[model samples]
Target: MNSIEVEHLTKKFGDFIAVNDISFQVKEGEIFGFLGANGAGKTTAIKMMSGLLQPTSGTAMVAGYDVITQSKLIKRNIGYMSQRFSLYNDLTVFENMQLFGTIYKIPRRELKDRIMDSLARLDMTKQANLLVNSIPLGWKQKLAFATAILHKPKIVFLDEPTSGVDPIVRREFWNLIYETASTGVTILVTTHYMDEAEYCHRISIMADGVIRLLGTPEELKKQVGVNTINDVFVEYVKH
Candidate 1:
């Protein structure tokens, strides 16, 4: 089953086209990488699918809800984590999660249990009382991810979720992503990291507001006669 279905989705700013008629589908349990250089329209497309923006002309169904008419429903069924730290710096980790859970309308009693369970999963139960700003950058990123899914949304949008972290941290973060995907939740991530892109089940490379390549990492490597996704990316964005 597909968690996201997009058809001829376009976003324009007056005469400038931000996202051209792009169409794609992300299947349940898949980690889809949306890659592009700066100003490549990846963010524009994501906002539309996430219901933060209205498309100029096209259609999108996210988590079985229409982006145009059912945006509130789509918002209810999705989680989002960004590269920028989105949690409250002054709040304790547990408090931060509690704030988001409350917004998601999770019951007060159940929310505490769920937050504790999630912290235990991350092995960060000891740090629950720590202020979010006091934690390491990597740990904060991981926490942001945990909080995003506390509601167990059907789909998650991770915008540069692994950015600015060390290689070891990135790997650990990917482990979290894999664990979530195993539970049949779809993830659509945008990143500039080529190595991280290789970890995706499939990737779409965008350039000048259009997708120039779409396939599995290995397929793209073979198609481009390259040995790694990094090289394939270099070949596309350099043009």
Candidate 2:
């Protein structure tokens, strides 16, 4: 089943088109990567799918809800974590989790158990009382991810989720993403890291507000006659 279906989705700011009639489908439980350089319309496209921005033309169905007509329902069923950390630095780890749970409307009876389970999985139970500002960057990213999915949404949108973290931390973060995907949660992520793009089951590369390349990592390399996704990206996006 396709968890996401986009058809001719376009976004325009007056005469300038940020996303030009782009379309794609993401399979259920798939790690679908949206990759591109800055100003390539990746962010615009993701914002449309997440119901955070309205498209100028066309439509998309995300988590079985229409992007235009059913945007509210779409938002409720999808989790989103932006490039900037979403947690409140003054709040404790558990407090941030609690706040997000309430925002998602998780039942009070189940919220505590869910919070505990998530912290345990990350080996972060001990740090639950620590203020978010005091925790390490890597741990904060993990917490942000956990909070995003606290409601067990059908789909999650992660925009540059591991942008500035170290290699080891990024690897650990991807492990969490994989574990989330294992349980049938569809993941749509945007990133500039070529190595991270390779981790995705399939990827779409946007250039000049359109998808210039789309396929699995191996297929893309073979199609472009390149040795790495980095080279493939340069071939299509830089030129």
Worst 10 residues of 2 by lDDT: 230-239
Q: All candidates: CA RMSD in angstroms?
A: 0.7, 0.7
TM-scores for every predicted model:
0.99, 0.99
Q: Candidate 2 versus the native: TM-score?
A: 0.99
Cα lDDT of model 1 by residue, 1-239, tens digit: 99999999999999999999998999999999999998999888989998999999999999999999999999999999976989999999999999999999999999999999999999999999999989999999999999999999999999999888999999999999999999999999988888899999999999999999999999999999999899999999898
Query: Which 10 consecutive positions of candidate 1 have the poorest summed lDDT?
Result: 41-50
Cα lDDT of candidate 2 equals 0.94
lDDT of each: 0.95, 0.94
Q: How far out, in Å, is residue 141 in model 2?
A: 0.4
State the displacement of the C-alpha of residue 157, model 2, in Å, after optimal TM-score superposition: 0.6
Report lDDT (Cα) of residue 14, candidate 2: 94
Return the lDDT, model 1, position 53.
98
